[model samples]
Target: MTVRIGIDGRVLTDRYHGIGRVTHELVRAMAGTPGVELVVFTGEQSASRRFDLNLMAMLPGVEVVPVALNAVDVRQLWRWRPLLRGAMVDVMVFPYHLGAAPLLGRPAVALVHDCILETDPRFAPSPQVGFAYRIMTALVARTATIATVSRASAREVERFYGRRVHPDHVIGNGVDRLRDDPAAARRLESEYGLEPGYVLHVGAQRPHKNVAVLVEAIAEVPDARLVLVGSADERFPDEVAPAIERYGVADRVTRLPFVPEELLGTLYARAALLAYPSLVEGFGLPVLEAMVSRTPVIASDVPVLREVGGSAALYVAPRCARAWAAAITRLLADDDLRDGLVAAGAAHASHFTWGAAAARLVSACHSLAGTYLAEAAR
Candidate 1:
């Protein structure tokens, strides 16, 4: 009998951000894996449009099931529970936590990217919202085969749940080099006045992301310009505007709402270094992405960053502006050290590929299926 699998495709909506990209890439790889019939649940009709036919053709043995309901309808979750039940899938994979709805198919595998919601209230619109995520996280931890992107995050998950619910799988996120275009880099340089080399920081201005501290540190580096990319959240404004004004480096900083995919490589390549002083991250993808772009990275000494960047990038204390500035200066001044890091980072990034991550996801799902089957037999 062929084992059936279900995936939540809601993340595929809104142009494939972090979680969405992970879901798409994993599903793309899993389509080739044998003995699995993939069913993707996009809880609303609108989301179906995002999964164009061309993309669907690549995935064999895959079904796209769109619920013909408004997005706000609570029924979207567990509405397809009956359908999944009727199909009797071995495992349903929620690529990210909160993707799990009530009463999902048994032997579910949930990918809890991070416990950021529990760990950082800066992510919450209010205390109630934070509490809700805490409860939701606990539910998934208790009910499913918890899979996470990093061992650090897996430990965080266990910590948040306050118990060893399951031996969470620490499947790392994959890194691939984006397409590079020198012409685009030139244009971006001209457009943004980024002719001089700059330190690139990619990610939202979330408090835990620690962009404010990075900005303060950049002020101390007289020659260094900081390029901040990522959509701004109204709830969590970039709290570093005062620092920017105070440092007299307002002209030195550039903020873009978004970076096109083609120019992302250019941003990485043209940068003197990628400085990621984030206080928390499940997987510091930008570190690996920068490594692939052949840029040296200087990131926080946080466990997750350390785990992901390994020996490929430099690590420093997350909160110390002086420490961050000193690290950036060291990388900027020493060409030999920068060159070595760039080469080592690429070698390190090579160890993480989408194929490897997909294989792990498949293994996790299969293992859960086998366990569920054995339990049923008893």
Candidate 2:
């Protein structure tokens, strides 16, 4: 018999960030599997967004539906409730860790990507919204089977919620090892006028990204330049300019406006080294992406990075400028260290695959549907 599966669609496509990528990967993999029927529910249509066509070609059983999830509007939630439950969705998977309609009382599985808000307080809103959402996460966790990306995260979830999570489902994130495209790498290097011997940093300039620490560290390395690729946002809105001026190595730091995904692989493949000194992260997908692209990475020794990068990355304290600088210089100067990191990264990255994650999720939905049968048998 075909198992009926419903997914929280907007949660997967709306952002297309870490959460969205995982959600899409899961859905795509499940669609290719046998004996499953998928109905994806979403608030909006992301039809135009670029997707890995390999995903579509692989999974033909999944269908996408557009419906307003009414994230904040209660009336919309109340109104959509009956219709969703009436549709007979055996199981609902919320990949974004957001809420569900009251109608989705069917055995639901919620992917708890991480507790970044708790790990880094600044990511939280003022005491009001922060505390409220944190409480909400706990409530939602209580209602669904908790799915965490790492053992570390699962432990944290259990600790925070003051209860053991359902150990039956703990699926780890997988890296899609990006093969090196030398021509593409060379083109990106030349297009950006980036020097061949530059250290690479990927991610947004968020407060907790701890970019300032790396900035100060880069100052110590006067010879090798630094190329930063990410959303050049205004988080440092006012402080960016003055900080660069004060640092004196502003002349050496080359910043890119924005490098789309196509060009990003090349950038990662050719970098002297990749540095990601964020204070906290949900899963730290970039660390794994860099590894897949054959780049040597030096990252903050945080839980997510450790879980994702393994021994493939050079770990440093987020705020330890001296340590970060020393680490970068070591990677640049020592060819052996760089090669070892690359080898380790490739091996570590090989341990992850989108298919593995999606398959387990498919089974979760099947289990959820079985729960209904057990209840009726009673």
Candidate 3:
């Protein structure tokens, strides 16, 4: 039997961040899957940063439904049920946390990427936001079939919400193979003044990201240059600039707020190592991205990162600047160690692909639809 699945595509109307990328890739792959038809409900396109929803709509067995509501629009909390029923979908998938209200008697799947807002106060920024997250989490936990990106994240969800995510429902994230471009590498060298073998960090400068510790580590490596590629969060304390100044390494560090994917791939290919000092994460996607680019990685000795990087990355204590510095220096000085890590990392990253993730999601949808239909017939 065909499983007609409905998904919240509002994430596609904005810049493609982690969740947006997951939703976009999964739907794109599911469109080609046999016996599956997708009804993607999207909001009006963003004027400044819109992802092309038409591309997915044009694919076989896929349809796009435009709504007046955005992803974060509070109205969706109550309004989504009727629209979902009207679409006559066998199952509904909420790619993010916000829009998954109880679907009356309908079966729904809620993708819980992480419970950072509930676990980390720094991420919540305010008490009201934290409280709202608790309510939303509780509601979704009771109503929807829970899914997450990693086993580590599933444990976290169980810890906080008392909801268990079965092993089969733990749909992990994936990375694409990035090709190296010599011309783009040269452009980065000339235009951005980024030298080859520089230590690279790619993530938003959030409080939990531990950017200050990375800056401190760079300071200890007198000859090492650093490239930080992500936007700075104003809500949290500004640590990157202050640390760069305090360590007197401003001249050695290049900060780019954003870069096109082509340049980002080149940066990843040209860097000596990718340094990820995040204290916590849902999946640690950058670890896989770097590995696919054949770049060595030095990440925090955190569970989620360990799950993603496996033995392919060199792990360091998240808060230890000296440990990070030593790891960076050792990796740079040892060619054999770097080459071994690159080979292992590439092999490890190959196991994770969007096609595999999409297959898992399609299976989950089929299971939900089959169960619901059997119950209805009874």
Count clashing residue pairs per candidate.
0, 1, 0
Worst 10 residues of 2 by lDDT: 48-57
Question: How would you encode candidate 3's per-residue C-alpha lDDT over 272-339 as one tens digit per residue?
Answer: 99999999988888899999999999999999999999999999999999999999999999999999
Which residue pairs come into collision in candidate 2? 174-352
Off by over 4 Å in 3: 13-16, 45-50
lDDT tens string, model 2, 1-378?
Answer: 678787776655433456767767677777757888777765654542435433443468876666765443446436645655666677777776655544455677778877767775676545575687787787777677778777777878877786465655777776675655667767776787764667888776666677777778888886877777655444334334455678987888777756755666777777778889888776788888888888889999987788788778889988888999899888888999888998998888987888887777777778878877789789
True-structure lDDT of candidate 1: 0.79
Per-model TM against the reference: 0.91, 0.89, 0.96
Q: Compose the digit string of candidate 1's lDDT tens values, residues 284-378.
A: 88898999989999999999998899898999999999999999999999999999999999999999998888888887788888888889889
On lDDT, the leading prediction is: 3
Full-model lDDT, candidate 2: 0.72
Error of 2 at 324 (Å): 0.3
Off by over 4 Å in 1: 43-54, 68-73, 86-88, 163-168, 190-193, 374-378
Note the residue pairs that clash in candidate 1: none
> What local distance difference test score does each model get?
0.79, 0.72, 0.87
Q: Name the runs in model 2 displaced over 4 angstroms.
A: 12-16, 45-58, 70-76, 179-183, 186-191, 232-242
Give the lDDT of residue 35 in candidate 2. 83
